[model samples]
Target: MIEMKEVHLIAKLADLQEVDYHNTLVLHALIELLVEKGLLTHEELTAKAHALDSQLSFQLDLASKLSETIQNRHTQIKPIS
Candidate 1:
């Protein structure tokens, strides 16, 4: 069900994730432009990024706990004859 455009966008985002300091400077410039246009505030951008980091951390911790519980439960299962 994935469209070509969506796949391309995902690839572009992945590339962006791997960007180095120079690319970060370019992105910072774009962020500044957006701020200048009143499209987004610096505080709002940073706040959302922090919130996302916190949310992902919680999800990762929960996933680790769940994985451990699943492994322990699996070990307790009896094989069928």
Candidate 2:
């Protein structure tokens, strides 16, 4: 038998999936419109996306390293009396 917690989790997952589907549809429509209007070509969009992805990845890595350093510093700190 499924537990109540399991049921709630399943419901949350379904909601997230629905939201993701709608967001994907909207993004696709916007991309198509931009391409159709000649505002941007597919190649340009792809290149920009790749550039942004790389930048974001670098930023995330830096953030993770900073977080780890903070954690280590906290562990090394002695509590003041």
Candidate 3:
């Protein structure tokens, strides 16, 4: 396993709290291990991460639009037929 010392340092520099800093170290270490073990090639990991990011961004955009629609719905004044 790659030494997580550098990752921890990075988390600290990024101003993550203690738990988050340590969790970042752990996450990096696990990813490194996965890459080293061939379970996830670097390219595969990169692609997967990018895909997830894109999906998450899309979900957030959809959620924002839905929320706006719902918020606006309450303000609509329907005319009597």
Candidate 4:
């Protein structure tokens, strides 16, 4: 069972995901407009997309590592019997 403190964290994560989804839609519309106007090329968009993907990948890996470390540290601490 998730503890009360962890429940808030989970909720916050959900909220962030919701916000990101909305932002992504807005960005897609802007990108479409830019492409239609000749302000940006498809190649430029693809390169930017690749760069964002790499950044997100790195951040997720780092978050996973941090979470693992925190869990390990939590397990190592002896509880008062």
Candidate 5:
């Protein structure tokens, strides 16, 4: 049998999905208006998004490498008596 807590969680998930759908619709409408008004071009938006994604990926990779280096260094340290 489904518990009351499980029912509440399911309702919350549905609410989140509705909110996400609404936000997506708003974003699409804003993008369409911007393009329609000639304030921005599709190519420009695509290029900027791609650039941002590339930068984020590079930063994440650098952070992962730095974290691994820190862990390795910590493991290599010797304790003082």
Candidate 6:
């Protein structure tokens, strides 16, 4: 059974776009939390964060290109929609 912390870590990793992955503020916080929860060792978490950061960079590049092609898009995110 996966722990909640592990589940959240994976989900957040997925949620992070490539550009924001390098945002030290974001990744560091996540890594720190994972470490605190014992879901990952400090070294392991740090290394994984770096790898994810690089992967996110590529994903961001692709998203940027695709964003331009998207028009009149409907956002699922809403406030009282």
The best candidate by lDDT is 2
lDDT of each: 0.95, 1.00, 0.89, 0.97, 0.99, 0.81
User: What does candidate 1's lDDT look like per residue over 1-81, in tens digits?
Assistant: 999999999999888777866688999999999999999999999999999999999999999999999999999999999
- TM-score list, all predictions: 0.59, 0.93, 0.70, 0.60, 0.75, 0.34
Ranking by TM-score: 2, 5, 3, 4, 1, 6
Q: Which candidate tops TM-score?
A: 2
Deviating ranges (above 4 Å) for candidate 3: 1-16, 77-81
Candidate 3 per-residue C-alpha lDDT over 39-73 given as tens digits, one digit per residue, 9 for 90 to 100 = 88888889999999999999999999999998899
| lDDT by residue (tens digit), candidate 6, 1-81 | 999999999888887865576696787888788889999997886688799999999999999878855632536445685
What TM-score quantifies how close candidate 4 is to the native fold?
Answer: 0.60
Q: How accurate is candidate 6 locally (lDDT)?
A: 0.81
Off by over 4 Å in 6: 1-39, 68-81
Better of 2 and 6 by TM-score: 2
Clash counts for the predictions, in order: 0, 0, 0, 0, 0, 1
Residues 1-81, candidate 4: write the lDDT tens digits. Answer: 889999999999999999999999999999999999999998998999899999999999999999999999999999999
What TM-score does prediction 3 earn?
0.70
**Sliding window of 10 residues with minimal summed lDDT for model 2:** 71-80
Q: What global local distance difference test value does model 1 have?
A: 0.95
Q: State the TM-score for model 5.
A: 0.75
lDDT of 5 at 70: 100
Model 1 misplaced regions, further than 4 Å: 1-23, 78-81
**TM-score-better candidate, 2 vs 4:** 2
